[model samples]
Target: MTDRRGVVAKRAEDLVSGVPYVRGWNRARRSAGALADQLVLLGLDSDFPGLLADVNVFGDGLVHLGTIGPEAAELLANLIAAGLEAEQHDTATEASSAMRREAPAA
Candidate 1:
């Protein structure tokens, strides 16, 4: 019974160790699919024939980024922060424009 338990535990541990890789693979696959969809939607598929392939490379890079080191993680964080800030700025600008349009002419 003890030997059987040990084998099961080892198998569980191995599966747990693979979780990160599985998650990364799923993320990369989704990212690639989204990129392909957007490319086709924008009609840029002909213009940038290799864009999807390039994006896949980037997706792989992102998947491995976390494993590289703290520096890579920090870089990714900074990118996310910058993107959020830009999105906020755009939203604010749009709101301001809408308000101005709605305001009664002086």
Candidate 2:
């Protein structure tokens, strides 16, 4: 199945590169928090490991980000959203069938 969240998170990562500093990321703490909050609503923050690795891979972490403060600490929502989104399937029967297929045979 095509992973929409993965696709969107990747798109967001790519889009972040086009954003600049001074006016892009070098804003006050509150503004950054708001942006982070937006990302939360988009369920993108849960891809942090992949996203951070992508940032480090491109060698533009410093340029793409300034400083993250405590105001942006509400990251659990992203984590929780990951499981909830991942669990979503067409129906309970499909989910059970997939689980059964993956389960070890006794």
Candidate 3:
């Protein structure tokens, strides 16, 4: 699988690097919520763990991000989207196979 969520992940990195600290991460809240909502819709409810992993990886690569808020929160949302996309892709592939087996030949 090529992992189709790479674009979202890249955007998150850009947001993290470019967006200045907002004292309390207010600017990143909406983006974060969007990510979380997308993940939930895609049925990967385990997004928080994946998000934490993503945040830790980001922190390790750069300066420690400290407590997640605002921008960091948005980054978490991106992580969730990435995870959901991956899972959904896999599930869709599986579903295609199942449907093929069940369908009558044309």
Highest TM-score: which candidate? 1
- What is candidate 2's lDDT per residue for 1-106, written digit by digit as tens? 3243232222224343544422422333345456456667877554432222122212222222324434344454555687687667446769799999999999
Of 1 and 2, the candidate ranking higher by TM-score: 1
RMSD of each: 12.6, 12.9, 12.1
lDDT of 2: 0.44
Task: Quote the positional error of residue 55 for candidate 1 in Å.
Answer: 20
Which scores greater on lDDT, model 2 or model 3?
A: 3
Worst 10 residues of 1 by lDDT: 57-66
- Write the candidate numbers in order of decreasing TM-score: 1, 3, 2
Q: Which lDDT tens digits does candidate 3 get at residues 1-106?
A: 2134222232224335634434223324545566567657865435343342222212221122235446546766787799899999999999999999999999
Number of clashing pairs per prediction, in order: 0, 0, 1
CA deviation > 4 Å runs, candidate 2: 1-63, 76-95, 98-106
Candidate 1 stretches with Cα past 4 Å from truth are 1-28, 32-66
Q: What is the full ranking by lDDT, best candidate first?
A: 3, 1, 2
Clashes of 2: 0
